[model samples]
Target: MNQVSSSNASLLGATFMLGAGITFAIINVITPIVTWQMGVPSTAVVFWQYVIATVFALPLIWRIGFGALKTRHPVAHEVRAFLSALGVQFFAFGFASGVPVWQMVALSMTGPFFIIAGATIFLGERLTVQRLGATIAGFAGALLVSQIGSEQFTWASILPVLAAACWGTVSVITKYLTRDEAPESLTLYMLVLITPNHFLIGLILGIAVAILPAGALPASLATGFDFMLPGGDALVLILLLGLVTAAAQYFLSLAYKVADATYLQPFDDLKLPLNIIAGWLVLGQVPGILFWPGVLLIIGASLFIMRQDRGRLPTGRSPIPETA
Candidate 1:
C-alpha cells in the first residue's frame, strides 16, 4: 500500500531491504563457524563485532565530535546498551550452539510481540485488538519453532528466545529515550557504550568460570570467557563479519528512509529464508519441519503488528537486532 510506500514500486527500499537480508544471512551463517567450529568465545565475538563497528564509525564520530555525547539520559543509554549487548551475546551463543539458522531467525521474529507488549506496559500505549492478537499468534509461532518437548530441544535452544526478549526490551527503552534524546546522541552512545558493556559482562563470566571447577558450566556456557583474539581464517571471517554488519546497518538506513515499515515488512522477513538457505548450503543444516508453519505465522503476525504500529514510532527505524 502507498500508505507505507513512498513511491510506486518502492524499488529502492525493497532493494535495500534485500541487501540487508543477504548481509544478515551471511552473518548468521558465519557466526557459528567462528564460535561453534573455530572456538572463538561468544562474548569475544560480540565485543569485537561492536568494537569493529565502532572503528568503522570513527569518521562519523569525529565528524559529530564530543558534543554529541552530551545527553541527559546517560543512565538510560547505559541500560539500553547493556541490554543490547546482552542480546548480541545471546544471539552469538545460539548460533554457537548450532541451532538451525532458520529456526533462530524465525524465533527472533517474536521481538515485535515483546515490543508491542512493552509499549503498552511501559510506554503507556494502548494495546489495540490487532496488536494483541498478533502478539499471541507470534508467540504461538515461536513455541512451535521452539518444539519445547522435542528430544532435540535443550537450554541452548532457548537462547535466541531470550535474545528476542532482550532486544525487544531494548527497543522499548529506545522508544522511551527518543522522547528527549537526539538521534545522533542515541547512535553515538550506543556505539561507545556497547563494547564496554560487553567486555564487563564477559569479564564477570570469565571470573566465575575461573572460580568454579572444571565442568561446572556447560561447554556452551564455558566456551567464550577467554580474552583471545582470533587468528588465521577465524580472523578473516570476523573481519568479514564486521564489514557485513556495517553494510547491513547501512542498508537498513537506506531502506527505512524510503519505505515505511509496514511496506518493508515482507522484505525484512526475507532474512529468515536467506539464512535458512545459506545454512543448508554452507553448513549442511536442514531446518526442522516446524520452521515452515512457524515462519508463516511469525511473518503474518509481524506484518499485522507493523501495519498497526505504522505511525506510532519513527518510520523505518527498527530496534530489532536484525543488523546485529
Candidate 2:
C-alpha cells in the first residue's frame, strides 16, 4: 500500500477504536446504575450482563464454526482464553460491591501497567524507561483519585487489578496463538468456550447467593424481568446495550489490523472521560474533583507509552504490510 492508503486505513481504524472506546465507557458507566436500579447484587447483575455479551457472540460463532477450529487447538487454547475471560468477568461482577465508581475507573486505568508487565514477562519484551515511569505515574494517579488514605480498602478493589493482569496475559497469548488463525476464529472460540465457564460460575454464585436465608434472592427475582408486555422496553434496552458492546469489539478487531497496538492503545484513554460523561448523562453521576487530575495522569502515561513504542519502530515503518 502507498503512504496515502496506509494513512487512510490508520485513520479509519482510529475512528473505529474511538467508537469502541466510547461504547465501553458507556457500558462501564451504566452497568452499576442498572444494578442499583434493579436491586440485584453485583454478581447477579454481572451474570446477566455477560448473558447479553454471550448472546451477541452466538451469531459470530455461527458465522464461523468448527471449520476454523481445525487450525487451532480447539480445546486447550480456548480454555486459556476462557480462563483469562473469567478474570475479566470477575472484575465486572465486582464492580458493584459498593466500591465508589470513580475509584474503580481510576484503578482500572492501571490496565496498561499490567499489560506492559505481561509483555515483559511473557514475551521477553523490554520495558523502556518511559513506559515504566508512565506506568508508575498511572498508579499514583489511581491512588490519588481513589483517595486510598480516606476510603476503606477491601478485597473487591483487588479484582480489577488482577483482571488487568489476566487480560495482559491474554493479549500476549492471543498474539501467540493467533499467529496463523483468523480473527473470526479466535473471537468465536473465546465467546463459545468461555461462555460455558462463565455461565457455570454465574449459576453457582447465583444459586449460592439466591438461596441465602433472607428473601434477597426472591426479591431480586421478583423485580428481575416482570415477564410481561411492559418489560419489552427493558429487554430492548438490554439488547441495544449488547449490540453497542459487540459493535465496539468488532471495531477494536478492525483497528488492530490497521494500526500498531501502541498507537491505538493511547486512544483507549478516551474511555475515562467518555465514561464520566455517560455517567453524568445517563445516571446523573459526575466524577469528583480528583477524577480530573487522575484522568490527565492516565492520558499522559498512555501518551508516553505510545511515544516510546513509536520511537522503537523503523523510520517510515507502516503498521500494515502491503498485500502486493
TM-score of each: 0.91, 0.77
How high a TM-score does candidate 1 get? 0.91
User: Per-residue error at 246 for model 1, in Å?
Assistant: 1.9
Q: What is the lDDT of candidate 2?
A: 0.60
Those runs of model 2 whose alpha carbons end farther than 4 Å from true positions after fitting are: 57-59, 62-65, 71-76, 152-156, 179-182, 203-237, 311-324
Query: Model 2, 94-198: lDDT tens per residue?
Result: 455544455565566666677688678876789877788999888777766665555566656665666655665565566556556666566656655554665
Q: For candidate 1, lDDT tens digit of each residue in 1-324?
A: 654454644889899989989988999988999988987877788777767766776765676577988988888889988988888888888888877787777787788888887888988999878788888888888888888789877778788888888899988998898787776677667767777988988988888888888898878777537667678998888888887777776677668667777788888888887888898999998878876787788889988887777777665453333333
Local distance difference test, candidate 1 = 0.79
lDDT of each: 0.79, 0.60
RMSD of each: 2.7, 6.2
